[model samples]
Target: MPTISMTVNGKSVSGEAEGRTLLVSFLREELGLTGTHVGCDTSQCGACIVHVDGQSVKACTMFAAEAEGAQVTTIEGMANPDGSLGVIQQAFQDNHGLQCGFCTPGMVMTAADLLKNNPNPSEKEVREYLEGNLCRCTGYHNIVKSILAAAATMRGEQVAAE
Candidate 1:
């Protein structure tokens, strides 16, 4: 087992992991962050997405040891310190972007990163950028709308104050 050290959900953590242990497993099993779900074992699904060094990465495709010295942010870390939902998460909830909630965490995290990179994304741009994330619920229309709405809110544009 290789000992890996990294910051997860704003807390520094060190642990021993098998060479083949994926980061998603490390988060869900060892760190008790079950919010990051594994919808598919293959990396094609973005359900296991998380922030690594400020970039969204598929945790299922990365080994825990490979994340040593990096910073990881799971869905559980997206909320405010007081446990209030983050703006992106709020947007998802307000817009009904989630149905089963299995993909919401990853979608919210990816949308947060997307908005951070480009605050005002067009509908086409949002669809294009979110191609990697698959949502079997809500038909993705609401998800796109939620992301755009969140983007507007983040940019201080008037979004009717929902």
Candidate 2:
């Protein structure tokens, strides 16, 4: 086993892992950040998405060793410093963006990345950007609404009543 270290959730962390250990495993088992789900063993599901050096990546597709010295942000880190829900998260809650909740983490993470790059994404753009993240529940209607509302909120504009 090799010791892998990274800055996770703005904190330093290190743990021993086999070279083949997936980053999601290290984050879940070693660091106990289970918010990053593992709905699929393959990369088809975005359930295990996380931010690696500020870009969203599928954690299950990358090895723990590859994340050495990287800055990783899991779903658990998406909240405010005082632990309140962040803008995107609040939007999800307010908009009923989640049903079973299996895909909410990845959806939120992806939304964060999208909003980072494009602060005010149109409904079509939001839908297009979320193609990689599949949500079996809610039919994606509320999820898209959530992201758009989050974008509006992040831009400091008033969110119209739905």
Candidate 3:
């Protein structure tokens, strides 16, 4: 076993990981940050999405040892310092973006990445950006709306009432 160290959610942390230990496992089992769900062991689902070095990466596809010295941000980190939901999260709740909520964390993380790159994404663009994430719940109408609203909020623009 190797001791892997990384900056997780703006905090420094280290844990033991086997060479085969997935980053998702390390995050959930070792770090106890279970917000990053393990929907599929394969990379087909984006439920284990997390930000590594400021880029969204599928935690299940990466080894914990590979995240050494990296800066990782899990869904648990996507909140205000006071524990309130972050902008994207709040938008999700406000727009009813979730149903079973199984995919909400991944959707939110992907939206964050998309917004960071394209602060104002079109409806089609949001749909395209979310291709990797899947939700067996709603038709994604409200999910798209939530991302758009979050984008507007992040841009300091007023979110028009639906």
Candidate 4:
């Protein structure tokens, strides 16, 4: 096993992993960061999404060795330093974006990436951006609304409650 060192959630972490170890496995089992879930091993579901060097990637699609020196951000890192919900997370709660919650982490990760590139996304763009993330519950209208609200809040605008 090779020892991999990476910055996870703004903390330096290192662990021994085999070449075939998935990033999600390393995160969950090795580091005990279970927020980055393993929804589908095939990468079709975006539940394992995390930001590697600020871009969202499916953890299931990469080997731990590939992430060895990268900066990884999981759902655990999305919170404010003071331990409050991050803007995106608060927006989801305010807008009722999640149901069952299995898909919320991936949705939040993907939304963060989308907002990083496009600070203000239209409803269509939010829907298009989230096509890769699937939610078995909450038919997606609320998710789209939540992302939009988060974008608005992140842009320093008021989030009018729905």
Candidate 5:
């Protein structure tokens, strides 16, 4: 095993990893950040999505060693400093964006990335952005609504109008 260090969730963390270790395993197994799920062993499912140096990447696709000295933000890090749910998360809850909860982390991570790039995405754009994430539950209606609502709220507009 080799030592790897990275800044995760605003904290400095170090761990041991084999050359073949994936970032997802390091986060969940070594660092105990289980919020980053492994819904699909393949990278097709975005359940293991995380922000790597401020850009979203599927953790299963990246080796742990590749993340050396990088900044990683998991779902656990998406909260306010005081530990309350962040605006996007709150929007998901308010709009009923989750059922079974298996896909919420991925959906939320993708939504965060989309909102980061486009503050006010159209409904079509929202639907398109979510194409990579498969939610067996909710049929994606409320997830789309939640993303739109979160975008409106992030833009300081009244969420009710959206």
Candidate 6:
């Protein structure tokens, strides 16, 4: 087992995991962070996406040991300290961006990272950035709207007019 340490959400965590243990498994099985879903074991599916060192990554594609000393943020960590959903999550809900909900976690995670890097993304940019995340429900129209709306909200703009 390899000793791995990282900050999850806002708390520091440390554990011993097998060298080959995927980050997704470590989060779900070891840390009980089930919000980061595993829709497809393959990396092709973005359901296992998370933030590592403030960047988005597919937990299924990385080993737990590799994340040592890195900051990790899973879907469960994206909410406010009081447990209320983040703005992006609220936007998804308000816009009905999710249907089956299986892909919502990853989508929200990716969207959060995207907005962090580009606070004011255009509609096309939102769609382009979300290309890696697949949603079998809602057909992505509302998803795009939700992302844009969330960006607006983050910028302190009113969504009621949009």
Cα lDDT of model 4 by residue, 10-115, tens digit: 9999999999999999999999999888887888889899999999999999998899999999999999999999999999999899988998999999999999
Q: What is the C-alpha lDDT of each candidate?
A: 0.90, 0.94, 0.95, 0.93, 0.92, 0.91
Cα lDDT of model 1 by residue, 59-115, tens digit: 999999999999999999999899999888988888989999998888988898888
- Local accuracy of candidate 6 as per-residue lDDT tens digits, 1-162: 677888899789987799899999999988888999998889876899999999999999999999988899999988888999889999999998999999999999999999999999999999999877888988999999999999999999987944
TM-score of predicted structure 1: 0.96
Against the true structure, what is every candidate's RMSD? 1.2, 0.7, 0.7, 0.7, 1.3, 1.2
- What's each prediction's clash count? 0, 0, 0, 0, 0, 0
Instruction: Please report, as a residue range, the 10-residue window in candidate 5 with the lowest summed lDDT.
Output: 153-162
| TM-score per candidate, chains pooled | 0.96, 0.98, 0.98, 0.98, 0.96, 0.96
Which digits, one per residue and each the tens of the lDDT, describe model 3 over residues 38-145?
998789879999999999999999999999999999999999999999999999999999999999899999999999999999999999999999899989899999
After the best TM-score superposition of candidate 3, give how far the Cα of residue 11 lies from its true spot, in angstroms.
Answer: 0.5
Global lDDT of model 6: 0.91
- Which candidate, 4 or 6, has the higher TM-score? 4
TM-score of 2: 0.98
Cα lDDT for residue 151, candidate 4: 93
Between candidates 3 and 4, name the one with more favorable lDDT: 3
